[model samples]
Target: MLPVLPLFVLTVILSVVSKPVVIRDSQFNLPVVRKLNFTGESTIPELDRARSQSILKRPTRIVHGDAARAVFDVAATNEALQYVTSVGVGTPPTNYTLIVDTGSANTWLGAMKPYVRTNSSVDTGQQVSMTYPSGSFSGEEFTDRLSLGSFNVTVQGLGVASRSIGFENVDGVLGLGPANLTIGTLFPDTEATIPTVTDTGFAQGVLTAHEVSISFQPTTEEVNVNGVVTFGGNNPSRFNNPISFVPLTATSPSKDFIGINQTITYGTSGFPILANAAGIIDAGTTLLLLATDTLQRYLTVVGGSNEPDPETGFYTISPANFARLQSLFFTIGDTAYEFTANAQIWPRSLNTAIGGNPNTIYLITADLGTRSGSGLDFMNGMVWLERFYFIYDVGAGEVGFATTPFTHATTN
Candidate 1:
């Protein structure tokens, strides 16, 4: 079991500074570290898939907001398969390790480490609560100095979790999702929308553009600093090709998050896997999730086991069949991005970390539960993003993709 703390505690002493401090270059990068969270039991892909579906099925509402950018280094853990970064809160600041999530929009902490009140901490007197497919938290809302990289938001809204469930090892989440999702999260102020870290930074003139970009590299290590989150703008050196921009899909719930429209095909044969459909590109999810029908089509072409592995809940292929696998192509906008053969398989070296047999081959692509045409039919999660450079331009309502060195690499 994880440690549990009281509802409120004051543990740190720090001096207060003016709100919204810009202490670094216009484009600053903060280094983040990734570490694994093992439950001592086997990892379950079914739970992850259910959580992702719940995230995508969130109630839809229309709201507008701006964004900002900064660069932060991100690390990944093999067991949980998430990218995390350290964020500083309070005046002098208490650093907390937070998962980088683009699927939900409520920045919060106190799941592991209790929130330390500083001279700069202000209780908003509003109760905040957010529910996720895997976890849930209810807490008092507070605004304080939030430090991301070198940029600071003097009065960023966040939750100080009084009670939480399902979150272990990490302090909380750094929500890089749409601001509209923040609505209805606060009690009594159910109509209010809290500005995200990116939005607040841009409003305070700390960022020039309302955008954030991500770069991830495939890795076999249990824990690796294999990614970077660039705020405000794209990092030219991260990608080899020009970025291709696509308008955020207007399809229902998909448009509520970082959603887009794309089609999928298998190899040079152009075997159709999924038709042009709306889906989300999320950092919070670990697997490459496709609709049930789409996954079935993919499995038919790949010739994997019809049944999911009991332990991992992922389809497995024999070594002989694995050798016959081909790349999957994702055509977004006009460009076709290659999802290499090796990229489809989970990192073999870290197989045991998730309680899988080292000799078994697990595929990252899994069923999204619902069938296609579910607006949010597919989700390109961490495994998929690892091969491409991703950008979310909040101000322009567009998402961009570009090829990285890892796009066709055999690192997995």
Candidate 2:
């Protein structure tokens, strides 16, 4: 004969056996540093242009919902002139330095440092591959522990690279772009879309809001810690003004990325540099790129030498012409954000780092190769981002921007 326990006793036993649900902090902040990885070559323009083109050619995944937040630190690297962050993977965590990109999504490593697997790493046996404007990699997919600052995702999906090309001085990339961009990255699972670090963190209840906020300050030094990435929510202290947001553009090509709608005009003249058009805000690119017609219009208005400098491949002007330069106004939603004259020019002190003469004055605006009406026209890259506080809200399908201390600074 079996004895039956009382209902109260059974409830007590079950309560003692169950694990408690952990509630994480609503937000986290990660500090990032900048490092100069200059190749001492003058090919930056070509490289930036190629990357922009590659980003435009990527497949678009329509996203309809939103999620929560967390934070991770990032730094500027010299080789590709991008923001890099240290990411820990697997059990006991081996730290890998990865480029932080907002133009594509697919977290992978093993370019400069080989990936180390541990008890927490589970190889999915699925082949994964991704191509970028600057590089490409092929590897096997794995689910592992991914840690950033104090937050941890217990079952994060990532790629372990067996072969790679074009990436230098860094392990791989921390893809912070849209989650849907992960489609077609894995073979045999071609229809599956890998959730991004942000997605996985939110799904695992590590973040309370599915949003990321980024802040960057202009600097002349080759290396500096002047940026921070906040996951789950925005760091209100980073911007001086209230953040204004616009829905992600529905236009194709640009719609595939963190796209938005805006118009650019030159100085007080208010002549259009670019009409209302679809474009992306990308951290993967180092310069502010515009359609060919827009670039030519800007050059004509600015009156700088039409020819690109032989060494740096950037439009150069004499100090006299620079003094006459005017601010470029980028009107997004209802606000007119000013792109100061100083912001348009490269930091003179770092000219030699990009193979330019220290005495030469270089402009940051460059040709995107294609003309307007391409659905994707302009790219507000890092150079433009440095002057503003930016936010990408994946779950809500919106992008936010606010003025920062550096927004109108003459740092350059």
lDDT of 1 by residue, 264-346 (tens): 99989998998999988876677898988999889888989898888767788889889999999999999999998999998
What would the per-residue lDDT of candidate 2 be over residues 1-412, giving only the tens digit for each residue? Answer: 0000000000000011123232322222233444344343436676677766775545655433333333443333332256777788988999987777777678888988888889999999799998765568899999899877666888788898999877667787778777667777899989887777776766665565566678887888876666667766666677999999998887877877888899999978798889999888887678888899989988998987788888888888789889999999999999999999999999888898777898999999888888898987988888898999998876667889999999988878
Q: What TM-score, computed on C-alpha atoms, does each candidate reach?
A: 0.89, 0.89
lDDT scores in order: 0.74, 0.73
lDDT of 2: 0.73
What are the RMSDs of all candidates, in order?
6.7, 11.0
**Model 1 segments beyond 4 Å from truth?**
1-29, 38-42, 56-80
